[model samples]
Target: MSKLQKSAWFNLGLITISSLFALLCFTVAASKIEKGFNYINVILCLAMMCIIIPLTLIIAKKKSYEAGFDEREKIINQRATSLSLSGLIITLYFACFIPFVALGGGNIIKVVYLPVIFICTIFTYQLIKSIAIIVQCALEEQNG
Candidate 1:
């Protein structure tokens, strides 16, 4: 497997694990924490972020930028990054409204879950982007 693929799989695996943990935050601790949009308990979500994000950057940097990218492949990566940025932006905007949409003005669980969703969504974006870039580069290489 290529360096890019390794990076993607590493990110996907790490974030998938975290995403499940985040989902569990709702189902497991929803009743345990005091309610009503509490931001304090977002600490667990923060812990996940603090742990996973550095790992992602480290893996991505170690990923072979040595692959000697051509213009088309570079373009593919650029486009993928742009798309990921767009995804995070949209997630940020929409997450802000979660409280307004919940009818009862949301719960602390939902508050906690919002960052989880955003973090997972960003991971999702990065994974898809890297995969798309790898595929596009492979196809371009084969055609030439």
Candidate 2:
């Protein structure tokens, strides 16, 4: 696989892992609070982000100017983002049902759905990029 493809796959994996962690935190927090913010969960989530940032930085460090990318990568990233955004919009469609926000971290369904939203966004983005790459390869073979 090309470097970009490999990176995309890697990112998909990271998103999955991170999402699982988020879900675990939400669930644990929800169980303890039963519909409220558990300070522990918030802290955990924050810490996770802290950890993720450094890791992302490390990945960026591995790539230099040449590894930066070209038009194809940009297109792939664009499609991936677009797909995730569509999913997000669809997910948010449910928000209209939410009577009031002032959630203050005290809603069972909301807590459960929060991680899910992240999952949907990440998966959609990865899926689009993966599909795009496959289609590109198929077209190249046919044309060649």
Candidate 3:
């Protein structure tokens, strides 16, 4: 796999694990404790940012920028980025509007959950971007 692919896979794995851990913590707190939302869930969710910081540093250290990318690679990356931006726009649109709609319908949501939604949006954006890159690579490989 290419360096970009490796980075994408690493990010995808990190996000998946972090998300599952947060979900597990939330589920346990809801099941074991009377309160559905608590500090534990918040802590776990926030900890994901911390965890990713180190992983990102490690990936950066391992990556060698000595070898430059070719025009084809640059084109693929540009296309993938554009696709990912479109996906993120859609994700953000729902993230902002859905909450307002729900709130207007008289549904009460905690402020803490808003952070989680934003975090999930970031996660979704990264995952989609990674997938787009991989898919573009595959298509290019198949065609040429």
Best by lDDT: 3
Q: Which of candidates 2 and 3 reaches a greater lDDT?
A: 3
The Cα error of candidate 1 at residue 113, in Å, is 3.7
TM-score of each: 0.58, 0.57, 0.70
Give the TM-score ranking, best first.
3, 1, 2
Per-residue lDDT for 1-144 in model 3, tens only?
A: 676666667777876776666555544544534556667755754565565566457546643641465677677667877887888889888887898787786667765466567557666776886787788878888897
Error of 3 at 131 (Å): 0.4
Candidate with better TM-score, 2 vs 3: 3
lDDT of 1 by residue, 1-144 (tens): 555545556666766676666566544445446554466456654665665677567656744673666566567767767877787777666666765576456445446465556656766676666667667657866887
Best candidate according to TM-score: 3
**Candidate 1 clash pair list:** none
Residue runs of model 1 more than 4 Å from their true location after superposition: 25-30, 35-50, 56-70, 97-110
User: What are the Cα lDDT values of the candidates?
Assistant: 0.62, 0.59, 0.68
In model 3, the Cα lDDT at residue 122 comes to 62
Tell how far residue 3 is off in model 1, in angstroms: 2.6
Pairs of residues clashing in candidate 3: none
